[model samples]
Target: MIPAIGWLLSSFLVAWLSARAAIAYAHRRGMLDRPGQRRSHSIPTPRGGGVGIVVASLLCLPGVLLGTAEPWPPRVLIGLLVALLLVALAGWWDDHRSLPILPRFGAQLLAVLLFAVASGVAGLSWWWLPVLVLGGAWSINLHNFMDGIDGLLAQQAMFVGTGLALLAWGGGQEALALAAGCLAAASLGFWCLNRSPARIFMGDVGSGSVGLLIFAFTVMLGRAGAWLLWPALILSSAFVVDASLTLLSRFWRGRRWYTAHREHLYQWLVRCGLTHAGGGVIYMTWNLLFAAPLAWLAWSHPRQALPTTMGAYLAAAALWLLLKRRCLRRRSNKDRHVAA
Candidate 1:
């Protein structure tokens, strides 16, 4: 308990201080995100604040492993760290200068493939290997997509990390639980600077690295049989639903899905008079009121996990459609008023 508490505190402080430093450095370097057509803010703000998050998480790795009461295999830890660093470096590069989609995606694919190979995912089935690799890459990109709003990505990270920690701890996976706990603490510290009326932006580095970390933790838990995939999916239903539905919507309309736009439900909600913080709170509320309970049920009852997960996603899908309809209706009404 003492070591765990120490780990959490140290991680939080490191992230917090690092974020402050990142803000200063970004401003000094003139790495600012100016308000634009597709943006949510009015004033320019410092970007790459997520460098602090990435740095803090990396710095705390040794302590997280050492402080764990139950030891993890050295190989597993080393592999996961290598994958994280790779993704973070790639994301950091993108943050500084936009990389072509193919190269950026190639980097993500390579990192995921490395992680899969390191984790012995090939033994599951040769076919499953490609699916996992692609899925890992999607997770990274989806997370980066969702980081558009203030506090949204950071808040979601906190919820997911804390949820993972609780589930792993309940399942007696102490090392995994500790890692998740550290993730939550780091996110919380960053969230202080990331919240609405934001002083800094997380940029690609924080979001991409966090997405990979979540994927890695879920895989680790699955390998340990401490939890199955269903609960993890349920825990992340909010992001899964939003990102998946939005992508499908764009693809169906024959829009260049890779292009950045403010078409996400969360973005629509923002356009409909919700403040950045308000939009973030709404997402956090969904996770707490809807996703969290269902995830808990799935985690606690393996036999019912599948049905519970399906039900959870079904509800999430319904909510997504409803939100879309409402946002569309609001836009239509505003258009009519403009025509008048």
Candidate 2:
């Protein structure tokens, strides 16, 4: 217990210090995200502070290998590191200057392939490969889409990481628990600088890497116990629902779904007059009041895990549609008032 606590504290401090350095570096490099038509913030802010979280998470690898008695191979550890670096490096490049979609996607796919290879996903047979590749790619991009406002992705990462950590611990998976705990702690450190009225944005460097970490955590948790994946999805319901629904709606309406836009439910919350912090709180509230309880129920009743997950997602989808419609109506009413 003491060692675990120490690891978490170290992760937090490393990320905190890294975030400070990233702030200075972003300023020096002129990597600022300026306000624009589809942007959430009203002022220009330095970006790529997510590098702090990435650094902190990468540092946890040695701790996990050394501290646990889990007999993982050195090759696997090295592969994981290489995979993380590939994604982080790609995102770091994009942070400095936008990359064309094809190149960005190529990097993400290669990282996913590396992750699968390192984890011995091929041993499960070739079929799982394509599914995971697609899922991993979606996980990477959905996070980038959802990271439009201050502290939102950080908050979600902390919540999901902590949730998975506890679940892994309960299932007697010490390595997975430690890894997930480190992610939560690192996110908490970045959150200090990332809260509303932000000091620095996470940029692509942080958001995409965090997404990959969460995906990795979920896969490990599922490996420990297949039933646990249901709860993992439950914990991630807020982001998944918002992003998936928004994308589907855009596609259904024949909009360019691949382009950046202020159409996410969270973005609409900001457009509806809530502060970035307020939108974050709303999402966090659902995690706590809705997702958390259902996750606990799923954990306690393994037999019902799948059903509980399905029900939770159903409710979340309903709420998302209702809230999104309300936001649209409010915008329409406000527009009428302005015209009158």
| C-alpha lDDT of all candidate models, in order | 0.85, 0.88
lDDT of 2: 0.88
Candidate 1 lDDT (Cα, 0 to 1): 0.85
Q: List the residue pairs that clash in candidate 1.
A: none
Model 1 per-residue lDDT tens digits across residues 168-252: 8777888788888889899889999999889899998889999998998887777667356778778889898999999999999
lDDT of 2 by residue, 226-327 (tens): 888888889999998999999999999999988989999999999999999999999999999999999999999999999999999999999999999999
**Candidate 2, backbone clash total:** 0
